[model samples]
Target: MSDSPAGQAAQKNAPHTITLLQHNALKGFLLAAAGLFLFACMDSTTKYLTTHYNVPFVVAMRYIVHFLLMVMILAPRHSAQLVYTQRTGLVVARAVVLTIASLCMGMALHRMPLAETTAINFLAPTLVALLAGSMLGEKIGGWGWAAIVTGFIGVLLIARPGGGLDAVGIMFALGAAAANATYQLLSRLLASTEKAIALLFYTALLGSIIFGIALPWFWENEAPSELEVILLLSMGVSGGLGHYLFTLAYRHAPASMLAPTTYLQLLWAGLLGWIIFDTIPDSMSLIGMAIVAASGLIIAFKSH
Candidate 1:
């Protein structure tokens, strides 16, 4: 209500600032959604590639190319911020966690269908909501708990006995889910001090080094065809771009609030699995996927 020049400037800028914030929120949501789809593409491609190569090699190639792409693109833009972080130990730990996730997911994809594998992984977001309270000090209400429980039930239906999914693959998928949940929580915590690019960079760096050393063990000496070459390279682009978008999204929005948006991954995975592999989830698994997605959506949108 002040009539001063500074006061008038503040008033004029208020609406613009509010509009900017809204635009960022919208952008973040779209990015998060698209990121998940790319992730589905990455996983589907991995599932296809794993049939021809070992898990470590597939993962190493993904990260090696990912690291190179970051150097070529993100490094120039972000400069030191891409290579440095206040939380050095935490950044390394987060990268290791993601590496574990990539390895587990790769192993799972070796035998599992893309849609089922991805639906199982959607448990990560619900698990994040469940753990946010204790790990990140974020509050979760009764509805959040309900959603988490529902998500578990959905996963159960998909992995139930006589469901035709491989037991080992299911176990690996569960491991990937746990690691991914931890990675998401760590990302949310680090976003306070670390730039998304820094977190992303360290992850690719660690993945590259860790898997690169073991590359000889799982090396495919026969050489890949043109299609295989494209798929291998696409993994890096999709993974790097997907995680960057997801990181930016969580930086702008709470991890829990952004949980529902990740369900788009289920849609993409199902579509890609069908199109690329000529596979579809059975009735039971489809129902389970629906149950899990609905629960996570309910939990995320409960307080939004």
Candidate 2:
């Protein structure tokens, strides 16, 4: 039987239920922002380390540390299960995609400023949204096309002729974005059958194993200072922790709400770039950054 009129009225009058949801959503937003900031820190540190080390070396050290940390943190709770997966091939494929994305991003940082490389990487989400129709079987409608075009225009602005941008750097950054989009799509495909920790574990483990094979060829054997070694380790730590925060945030909020917050990483990237490398975006680049962010925000809101 339905609730009595008084009970229904009482439930309607209760504000705490609404308050709780609002509180949780707010917490999600803050957590996402914090995660993005942490990731920005990771990128800044990666860029700094690349100046003293090769991209392969930096990437290998990062995943090795990440793998060790995962074993230490997750082994107690999910030792054997860490590698358990219903879709082993997809899992390995996902890892390969992310590993390639990491390599491209590292190379981009080696050639481009942190903010610009980051700006280009921001295209990942827009691509994901546009491809969702064909890839994820979700319709994007007209607004999605507009957002895609807007994002592309923003990229053109930043990568315009004689913008002092390296051709190879721009290419690498675009490659990273495309690979990252593939990674996101694979994560979605595995979301139903795979544990989040399992995916994380494999990404780090596979990256470490694959890169370890090539480490000997690229190893410079330079004795990094104490600070450099610490910084390199911090890169992996920040990456693992940042992704953890992002996962936790989604537990409290939907992806649509969190999508817009991802753009905040660009701002964090710009600030950290200036502080660490004294690199500032030019006026035109800043405008381009604003446009890219606006396009992402539009899609996020529209998706809602």
Candidate 3:
């Protein structure tokens, strides 16, 4: 029988709605890809700067610029309330842990290939999955466990004895992974009670304060050239803007849909590493990265 006018109107609008949704998803994916590229650039810039500056100085400068950008970008809406939080202690701890993670990752990058260090750091999501049940009271099924195990195997492939990767860099990358996993877990816990801008501001403020205080002791005596200065500032600009783009991406797509796009960072890291430093991961290392990425993708799809 003929449908009512309301039913006909609803049917007419459904395809247009679906098209709009698909468009938004495509935009989100592009934003995520761009953010990953910017992040890769930030890492490459930090690695380059380490040749002339101490790790602490490079890290501090990035966060110092990050802090200034946060003030300009977030303060208008949040005002002094940018520092307010429901769980103050957790927020502070999250900032501290993330700072430590950056320091460790910086140290690793200074001594290792960008692809290798970045691959090892990919263990963070696996660690989060493994620890979530105990730490966050979340449940993980057999698939999650399998993915975690596979991820560790990938780590072993990259970091096995005599793999030609530096032992110190390997240790630093491992530390960064653990620290980052903890940071991710904490961020999840706080997401319910805290504003994203407020959390972002705290991390920027804390990173700057922590690293800036230590900057004096780690200062390089030689002055940087104007070009070096630009690159150094670019670290923060890229990092800050990359993070902004990353957050913006989730608005258009769910985390599950966006999660796999993060693996694009490995590609960006490899390209940047090759272009900037003339290095690429060897055959075994590439296989290891593939394993790590597969494991992470499984978890992302399953968790979604």
Candidate 4:
């Protein structure tokens, strides 16, 4: 009954190992939940801004504030190197896509109900599943295909071709979904080798530059009030912080484990929309959201 050295070491480490695993799991769940909360908050803030301000002006200001905050936070730690990157093209592409997505989401927020816009954005995950198979050569099975189709159908239910279609709003939502899919796919490609902090730093820096150039065309005649400016600033800071937490979440657990939790954002969006604007979604909208959420949850579970 004598224990070997390796067995003794394993026994000694067992409790510590179990404790570490539990800590990581709890951290991942908390990070994922926080990320969702921040995202919902960003959407709510954007909706508020768009109600009273030009979409582009709000978007530009938000990115500018985000860029400045990132510089303030990361510059002391890593100077000009924040913009230095071997993947310059990839970085630029990510920035462009993200800026465009933000613009489109802003437009959607201006015109559509918040919950509906959030639900449509969730279509990005399904698009990511398909793109991973095609662009990244991942093996997505039959269930993945089914989920993609089901999710698209839910979008159609919301858009309602001829019934409730606000062509501009629907198009904006779709564009946002596409941009989000591209962003997620690029993140997956980079995550295998790049440091998460570096990736995020570059995204904020480049996004600021790209959006900065575009800001002149959309600048408003009147400056935003103090309260509007504060919300815009909060949006950028929260968005950047959320991205950081999400990166931490992935380090602790598989994406599949945390993916389904994103549906919680729809609920948050719905509640925010109701309270802030007294915007209650109709029965059809609720049903459409349910379909989208259920299909997305199934997709996340099946892919896992």
| Top candidate when judged by TM-score against the true structure | 1
Specify the poorest-scoring 10-residue window by lDDT in model 1: 15-24
* Candidate 3 lDDT for residue 184: 65
Measured by TM-score, how close is model 2 to the native structure? 0.86
In model 1, the runs with Cα more than 4 Å from the true position are: 1-25
lDDT of 4 at 264: 78
Clashes of 3: 0
Give the clash count for each candidate: 0, 0, 0, 0
Give the distance in Å from residue 226's predicted Cα in candidate 2 to where it truly belongs: 1.1
Q: 247-267 in candidate 4: lDDT tens per residue?
A: 566556544445555677899
> CA lDDT of each candidate?
0.85, 0.80, 0.79, 0.74
Residue pairs in collision within model 3: none
List the candidate 3 regions with Cα displacement exceeding 4 Å. Answer: 1-34, 137-139, 245-261
- In the range 71-114, model 3's lDDT, one tens digit per residue, is 88768886855776667899899889989999999999999999
State, as a TM-score between 0 and 1, how close model 3 is to the true structure.
0.83
RMSD of candidates 1 onward, in order: 6.1, 8.1, 8.5, 7.5
For each candidate in turn, the TM-score is: 0.90, 0.86, 0.83, 0.84
| Candidate 2 lDDT score relative to the true structure | 0.80
Cα distance off (Å), candidate 4, residue 37 = 1.4
Candidate 4, residue 294: the lDDT equals: 80
Candidate 4 Cα errors over 4 Å, as ranges: 1-29, 137-139, 162-165, 250-260
